[model samples]
Structure formats: C-alpha cells, structure tokens
Target: MLKFSILKCLPVLAVCALLAACVGPQKQTAGYDYTAFKSAKPRSILVLPPLNETVDVNATNGMLSQMTMPLAESGYYVLPVAEVAETFRQNGISLPVEMQATSPKKLREIFGADAVLYTKVTQYGSVYRVVDSSTVVTATAKLVSLGTGDVLWQGGASANGKELGNVDFGSGSIIGMMVQAAVKQVAHSLADKSQEVAGLTSQRLLSAGQPNGLLYGPHSPKYGSD
Candidate 1:
C-alpha cells in the first residue's frame, strides 16, 4: 500500500516542477519596441556620446564610437561624426572627452539632426556566490523628435554572462576586468537597441508624415515636422 501511495505522489511533484520551469525568470530580449514613432524612411541622426554613469574613464565615448559604426555601416542616416564635432565647436560646446554628456534632442535642433539617440549605462555588477555567478548591465535609449519636444520611440536592454572566479577567469576576476566585461555586455545590448531605433526612426518619419506611410522615406517633406 505504501509503494502505491509513493507512486501517486511522484506524478504530482513532477507536474509542479514543470510548471515552475515555465514561469522561471525570462531571458533578456535586448530588442526595441517600434510602436511609438511613426514608421518612415531613415533620416539623418546625430550620434551623441553616451553618458557613462559608471566610474570608468573614457568608457562612454568608446562605447558610443563602437555602437555608432555598425549603424552607420547599415546605410542608416548617421550624422557625419566630423560635422557633428564641427557643429559643437561652432556652438562653443567643447567635447568632454574626459567627462562629457551631449544632449541628443538639443543637438538635433542645432545641427539639424532629425532624430537624436541618447544612451547611458545605468547599472553594472559582478558576483560569484554559492548559488550563482553572473555579470549584468542596463542601458536606456530615447529617440526624440527634433521639432517637437515629443519622444518618438524609447527602449532599453540588458545582458549578462556566466561569471568566472578570479582564479578560473581567463583575465582573472579583477574588479577592472569584471567591470570591463559588464560594460562590454551592456554595449552589445545597446547596439541591438540602436538597430531597432534605426528601423523605427525610419518608420516613424513615415508614420507622422505620409499618413499612408512614406515612399521617399526620410526625403519626405513631412519628416521632422509638427
């Protein structure tokens, strides 16, 4: 009788375990949502150096430069980096290579950037506990319309990787090493987000202008309008 009773309880326990797995913490998508800004053709965009809220020197600029290249190569309307730099000089706003934060929307108005990209590393950490080992970071981006103060589309993403102890770690688990890895992970996620912004920015320009969507894309006169 006891054997039969044990068999009956085993199935119940198995069912509960399967349900828990289904509801486990979700993996990061690190993708953008394109519903906000109207979908239109790709337009000119200013590449602002991201703000490194973390205590890493030149990390923000590095990440911004790395992230911007892929978008520019995609045939997207990446504002010329040199021209943007010139615009800053023209406007008396010096680049804070040491520690600087550029306003995407404001720059849009100054240099005619139809859309502005604002990226920042919000958080990062690393730990190898008895239970788990991991590193993570969070970044938020907002694409604002140059004309109105309205935000066209906004999104954020995060990433993490299995952490290795100081000994087993290839670079050793030094604080600097960990932070670099975390920041890199965050930068990768932000790149994914930039692509989404590029696609949506193109789309929104179409949406807001040609109610029927744009054929000439960014060239549409209705782009960057009220």
Candidate 2:
C-alpha cells in the first residue's frame, strides 16, 4: 500500500514542479546591443532633473539627487546636479519637461557634456493594504550622446522597503493587522521610506558593473575591460 501511494504522488509532484517553473522569473535570451554605447565612449555625463510621472511631489528631486554617486563610482564625471538645476532656472527652463526638451546641441554648447542622462520617475511612495504597507521607488533612464543625439543606453530599476529588510505589519487578527498597517504607513511616510528605496534603485540603474548596465568609463581602473 505505501509503495502504491508513493507512485501515485509522482505525477502530482511533477505537476507542482512544472507550475513553479512556469511562475519563476524568466531569463533574457537576447542581450542588449551595446554598439552605440561603445562607439560613443562618453566621459562626461550631464544628469538632468528627472521628470515625475507619479503623484508624489518629491519624486523628481529624490530620484535626481540619488543619481550622481553611482555614475561617479562608475568612472564618469557627473556634473553637479544643484548647479545644473540652477542653470536651467537661470535660463527660464525650470520645468523638467522643458529641460529634457532642450536640444542635444544646445546642451552640449552650454555644459560641454559628452553625454546626457534623462530620467523619469514612474513610481514613488507608500501603498497601504489592510495587512501590509510597502514603500517603493521606480525609475527609468536614457543616456544620449550630445554630439550625435543617439541614445547610447537605456534601463530601468525599482526597489521596495521589504527588499531592504523592512518588517511586515501583518498580524494574526484582522483588526490587529489593520492597526499595524496603518501605523506602518504613517511611519513610512514620516521617514520618507521611498527616498531610501530610490537610492538603491539609482545604484542598480546607473552602476557600471551590472549586467547590461553602463559600461565602465575612462576614469575607472577597469576602464576598457567591459
């Protein structure tokens, strides 16, 4: 009887394994084309204010402020963001849309940048459910050559509080779960949890060594290795 029962469960076990494989993360078979990015060989990068597509008012500056360090660590000279924003303001182009709209030729003329990085914040902030609250940040970026006006590279990244080890607010009782979620939401908002996630997202999006990420720039010791 035991042997028969084990043999009967084999098909069920195989079906469960098949279901798990179906829902697992898919791997990319085709890699990104790096022809344009490699040919550009840009050294100086100009990061523009990020265009915000979400309801969060802080998304633009939050994402923009987190971008520089990763690019610098990747071996590119990232122009100071504060000075860049001020320059836009002085030129009467205070809106991110306007800043992004400025022609590549004009940007090169003004900043002498070899490349420009334009970013859009698609999601930023906390979402509350009855038993859970999560803070997430998501953004996409494009690197364009100033001289040729060709997009050299493009990628996106997203991060969440739970991924950073944020504790879950779920509870045994429904009422307790709701209360914990509410408190967690309030704390997350007060602490600006999304901004912390943004920093991690920026690192993943802009770091050079990442798969299909920006290639190492001239200043890096491993330059030309990529």
Candidate 3:
C-alpha cells in the first residue's frame, strides 16, 4: 500500500540517514588522555565570529550559528552574544554595527573563557564551476589555550548542498533554498565534529589531570576510544 509520494522522498531520507552514518561512528583517535579539564566545568565559553574570508560575506554567520548549536546541545553554559559584544566595546575593539566576530584576547577578557575557539574559512562558495555547483563549504576550527596560545583541539567540516540531479541549483531562488539545505547538511557534520572534538578534548584534559574548564559530551564515544 505504499504510495509513489512516499517512495519519492526515499533519496532525501536515505541521504539524511547516510549523512549521520558517515559522520557518526567516526574513526576514534588513539592514545589520548584527559584528567585536567573536567575538574572545573566549562562554566562559560564563547565562539568568536568565524573569519569570513569566503567568497560569501554571510558565510561567517553560518559557521557561528552551526558551532553554537552543538556546544549548547552538549550542556555547557554559553556566554551571551551581547555580553561578548559589550566586552569587545570595553576593550577598544570597534566592531561594526553588523559585525559579530570575536577576537581571541577579547574573548578571553569578556567571557573569562579558559579557552577560545577560532575558526577560519579555508574554502567557501565556489572556485571552479565547470564540474559542479560551487556548493561545498569548508572551515578549519581550532581551540586555543587562553593561557598559552597552544592549540588544544582542531577540527574541520565540509557541507554538500542540494542538487537537482546534475543541474546546479546555483542559478536562482533555488539558490537560497540550496544554501539553507547546505547549512543543514553541514550542521550535522559539524555536530559530529563537535562531538569528536569534545570527546578528544575531554581525553586530553583527563590525561593531563588538569581542569582545562571545558567539556564536550560523551555522546561522541569515539573521542574517548581514540
């Protein structure tokens, strides 16, 4: 009694399922230990506005928003944007009315974050269009120790946009929809990345026996095994 309409969404559903499968059960890193960071829970943390550096000016918001969801989902107390903004103001960093990116030092001073996460967009929009719709976006995120500037954790993710078969959706109104679809796709990947980062960061903190003040959830068991 299955209708064609039900069958029609099979690919979309299948892709969505596969996307999680691909990111989940991810390869766990080996020989990592943590003991230092868990002693003091990460009371408040801040994600600096990602550097756009992309062909698209709006790319920064996409990453920032995506990054927030995973961390918030994991249960850490996140610093409010307004507070971070105010901190920036007091520090003498003049952010444009529309700007929201956070600087490293400013993040430390404003949120008193034990660590700061910095992200740089390495690839965005499209560079070569002949083969596919320049719909793939990638970013490199690094967690730096506020005390030493040492990178505590690092991860990256790439999102694939909606495709109407072989035709690129990059030409019209569909572009906006495609961009949104891409963000959703990327959000899942970034969530996985966040899980992995949190897991690994936990291990690092636990191994060091130092309370680094941040904790990623155990949902990502791969972080512990690796």
lDDT tens per residue, model 2, 19-80: 87876634333467789999999999999999999999999988888999999999999999
User: Please, what are the lDDT tens digits per residue for candidate 1 over residues 16-43?
Assistant: 9988776663322333334445552336
lDDT (0 to 1) per candidate:
0.51, 0.92, 0.51
Off by over 4 Å in 1: 1-36, 39-42, 73-75, 95-106, 124-137, 160-226
For candidate 3, the TM-score is 0.50
Q: Cα lDDT for residue 133, model 3?
A: 35
Candidate 2 backbone clash number: 0
- Which runs in model 3 stand beyond 4 Å of their true positions? 1-43, 95-107, 126-128, 163-226
lDDT of 1 at 167: 24
- Between candidates 2 and 3, the lDDT winner: 2
Query: Residue 144 of model 3: what lDDT?
Result: 62
Task: Estimate the TM-score of every prediction.
Answer: 0.47, 0.84, 0.50
How many angstroms is residue 97 displaced in model 3 relative to the true structure, after the best TM-score fit? 16
lDDT of 3 by residue, 1-226 (tens): 4698889989999999998887765634332324333433343456666676666665665555556545655544456655666766677764432223545565566567766666676555433333223345667665665555555655555544332122333444655666745654455344433323323322332221123323453443333332
Pick out the ten consecutive residues of candidate 1 with the lowest summed lDDT.
206-215
